[model samples]
Each structure stands twice: as C-alpha cells, then as structure tokens.
Target: MTDPANPLVSTEWLEKNLATPDVRVVDATYYLPVEDGDARAEYEQEHIPEAVFFDIDAIKDDSNSLPHMLPSPEVFSSKVRKLGLGDGTRIVVYDRKGLMSAPRVWWMFRVFGHRDVYVLDGGLPKWKAEQRPLDDHPVLPEERHFTARFDTTRVRDLNKILGNIESKAEQLVDARSAGRFEGRDQEPWPGRQSGRIPGSYNVPYTNLIDSQSGCLKAPDALRRQFEDAGVDLQAPIVTSCGSGITAAALAMALDILGHRDVALYDGSWAEWGLSDKLPIEKGPEASASVSTER
Candidate 1:
C-alpha cells in the first residue's frame, strides 16, 4: 500500500485530520471541455467544508498564451499567501473529477519547493459519497507569508524536448489515451494536432486510477501500468499531455510511487501540436519491458 502520509491522503484520513491547525484543503477542480460546467460556479455552490477553491487557470502564468502555465515564483507566493498557505500548512488538494486536476496543484506546489502537500485520494466525490460535510460559505483566510523557491529541474520546455528527440537523454511519457497519442482521434483543444513526440511512451493517467473510486489504484497496479506502457522506473522521465494538465497527473503518480528523476513538459502536445516545424511521429507503439525486480 502507498503511504497515506505520503503524496496521497485518504478521504477518511482527511476527514479525521481536516481540522488540524496546519491542515488545509483545496478544491483544485478544472473542468475539461467535454465536462461542462464552470468550475468556479460549481465550487461556490457546494464544496468540501473549509476547502478553498484553487483555480487552475487563475494560478498560472497569464503572460503565456498557453492555458495555465506555471506562474512566476513571486506571483505564486502572493496567490498562495492569500489562501493562507504558509510554510507549515499541510495542503490536501481534491477535485470534481476524482484526482484528475487535483494532482496538477500537487505538482505545482512541489515545483515551487513546498513538499508538504498531498492529494485527497478519491477527491470530493468520495468525500460526499461517504456523507462528509459540505459548506457553501466563503472563507476569508488571513494572509500568511508564503515563500516560493522555483525548481527548474522539475519542468521541461519545448527546446529541451526537441533536443531530447535526438539525444534521447530522457524518456517522454504521454498521458493521453492511445488513440490520441496515435493520432487516431482529434485533440480536445482546438487547433492542436494529434500524435506524440518522437520516441515518447504512452501511459494514460487513467491507467493509474480507478474511475469508480476516484482514488489511485494500489501501488502494485500503478507499477504494472507504468511497466506495461514501457516506462522505465529507473530512467529519467518527462510526462506530457494536452496542454500540460494530464501530464501533471502522471507526475503525481510517479511522485507517490517514489520515483525521483521525473519532470513535466510544460508545453506538452498543446504547444508541440500547434507547431508546423517540429517533427512528430504517428504509428505503432514502442516495445516495453516490465521489470523483474521485486
């Protein structure tokens, strides 16, 4: 079993620890185009009691044309401080689609040098299904001092990915479905092309999670999923998806599984697919070897 005290905290565990002075919960829901409804509007209606809404779009680099790129460290610090997340706060992020968008916030915190954050396994649906409390009231959190330390090593830009195509310095993992990765289906984001970066692997984020429970699969199942997708646990990896959202989901899964040398491609297919010059491959899946260790 993966540790509840690690990158994931159970709904039951959150229920028990939610009131702890240093514990803070965030509703980090970002609705995909297919899933209709305004995230902010839904959050305002009913949410986990005492949970603050962490808007994925709001906490991003507004200067970037892309959707929800990581914000500057100073900006991140300012935004989080307003949310009352300080040095000692243990953040637990949840979302409407189970652990989908919640892990992105989890990754964002880690990228900004805060490691005390965890994602609420199964998220709010599980909380509500278990009859947990909800509060529509807004919380006016007292501003606290937040320090942001940007870690460049955790992110990959387009230039770096282009270099990797030839160098093969790191493995690229696409979190999109096989159909999308293979260019059999169109991209959800308009104007973006389908297909994946050359030499990238495919491990849909959903493979590591249970749709019914909204929680990540057991640790062994997660390992198997990655292994089946040709992900080398021992090698350096960069995860990507459409517009960088699901890529964070892969990062969160890897983090919980205790893999270290992992980074996320901030541009992902959103940027790469839009470009005409960048070379992309569309074809058969790569061969993967499941590890015999353990």
Candidate 2:
C-alpha cells in the first residue's frame, strides 16, 4: 500500500521539483563512529540548495541513557519548527550514504503525524555524481507552526517490549545483519551483547533498500522480501536494530506496506544488548525460530 502521492522520490525528480514552495529538503545524514565521518560538518561543506541539516543525534530524548532515543512530542515539534518544517511543508530528507539514515527522519515525521514526508533516493552521493546542484550557502528558515501529534501507539518503551515478549502479543523484528542477530559477530558498541531480543525476526535493513538506487523496493517487492525473511505482515510487529537507527528503516518499510500498528523499540540493542541480565541467544537458531509463536 505505498502511497501513490508520497512514494520515495529520485534525485532527478528532486532536482526538478526542489524549487517548489511547499518542498523542504533536509540533509538527514548521520555517520557511524566506525566511519569516522562528521555528518554536520559534511552538510556544512556542501548540500542541496536550501537543504538544512537535521541533526538526528540532537533531536533525541535526552532523558534516556540509550543513544538517540525518540524525543517527546513537544521536543520534536520545537526542534522541527526551528528547522522550518511545518504542517504544510512537504519534506524530502536525504543522507550522505544514500539510504543509511534518512529513513529515520522520514519515520520521525510519520510518528509526529505528518504524512507528506519522503526520503531522497540515492541521497547526496547520487545527487553530486549526477551533477544536479550543490550549495554551501547557509539557510535561515522562517519559523512556522508544526503541530505535534504524538502517537503513543507507534512507540514501544522498555516495559512494553518486555510485556510483548512475555505475552507474545507482537512479533519482534530486528534489522541488524544476520551475524549480529545471531551473536556470531560482536556488537559495534563496547560491552554490548551480540544477540538479538528473544523471539525476534531478522530482516536486515539492506534487504528492503535498493543498493544501487538507494530507494526502498516496490510494494510487492517489499512484501516478498519480508515474507522471504519470515516476517508475518498481519501480526503486530515491533522493529529494533543497533542503537535504534536501522530499526527506523524497518519501520519505514512497514509504513509503506501499510502496517500501521508497527512500533519502534527506541532503546533497541543499545539498551537491551548492554544489559547483562537480559537473555542472549546465540547462533542461527535465534533467526530460525523467529515467528514460531503464533
């Protein structure tokens, strides 16, 4: 059920339509520590004209110890308003390495009840490679009212995740790579466990995205991808990934597939993996037994 009006846009489409008054381009780039790239610094160096940098790290819930957890509705509204995003604006978000981090911002807007948002396919890399346009000029945006409608049902806290695990009320989906999900590879974060949450399915975020195009796959294609990975579309699903980044990608995929009940585990592996008391299952058995509970 991909929205006919709001499907992911390509670099060519953005280049042509960027000048539209209602369109607001945002550089939603975020880099991993392993990459050693500064997202804000890169955004400042060069970006799409009038595209402001949306700091994913800064708009997080500061009260939580976990990394980049979703902020409260009030906080989110204030931060987005400062960026010139409002109810009437049609947002187009992009990241440095294509589909890496922009989907998180796309999902954030949806969480706040904005449906006019989309991710820029192929991101800055493709845009620069195609020689579309780039501007180093700083943008000062006028303030506007961005109504924040916090959908509590779209988010799952630690307690809700624990309860879901115990009650088997929802299917848990992990977007980490197969190795990380199975504990065969170590976590990127120090002292964090490698395995996924109990009874979680593994559908790496990479699978849902086109490597070359950097856009999400078509709806039928996405459906098959999830089914092939053993995900039950009809069941309630909660998505998780390392530090809650890629988990948002999973949530975005579900959104395009018309799965409205999907919830994101904000703490994700950052919180769950670091706790010694939490159960950790190793090997492919963890992935194999996914969705066994009805």
Please name the candidate that would achieve the greatest lDDT relative to the true structure.
1
Return the TM-score for each candidate structure: 0.93, 0.92
Where does the lowest 10-residue lDDT sum fall in candidate 1? 285-294
Among residues 3 or more apart in sequence or in different chains, the pairs in candidate 2 whose N, CA or C atoms overlap within 3 Å are none
lDDT of each residue in 1-294, candidate 2, tens digit only: 224455478888888888888889999998766678999988888999999889998999898777888898999999999999998998999998878789889888888998889888777888888888998999998877899888778888877887777799999999999999888887887778678787788999998877766667888988997898888999999998988888888887787788878989878888887777665566755555333222
Indicate the residue-level lDDT of 238 in model 2: 92
lDDT of candidate 1 over 1-294, digit per residue (tens): 225447988888888886888888898999777667799999999988788888888988989998889999999999999988879788889998897888899999989998889988888888889999888999778778888999999999999999998899899999999889887788888788677788899999888888777789987888899999888999999999988888988888887688889999998998988877787777555213211121
**What TM-score does candidate 1 get on C-alpha atoms?**
0.93
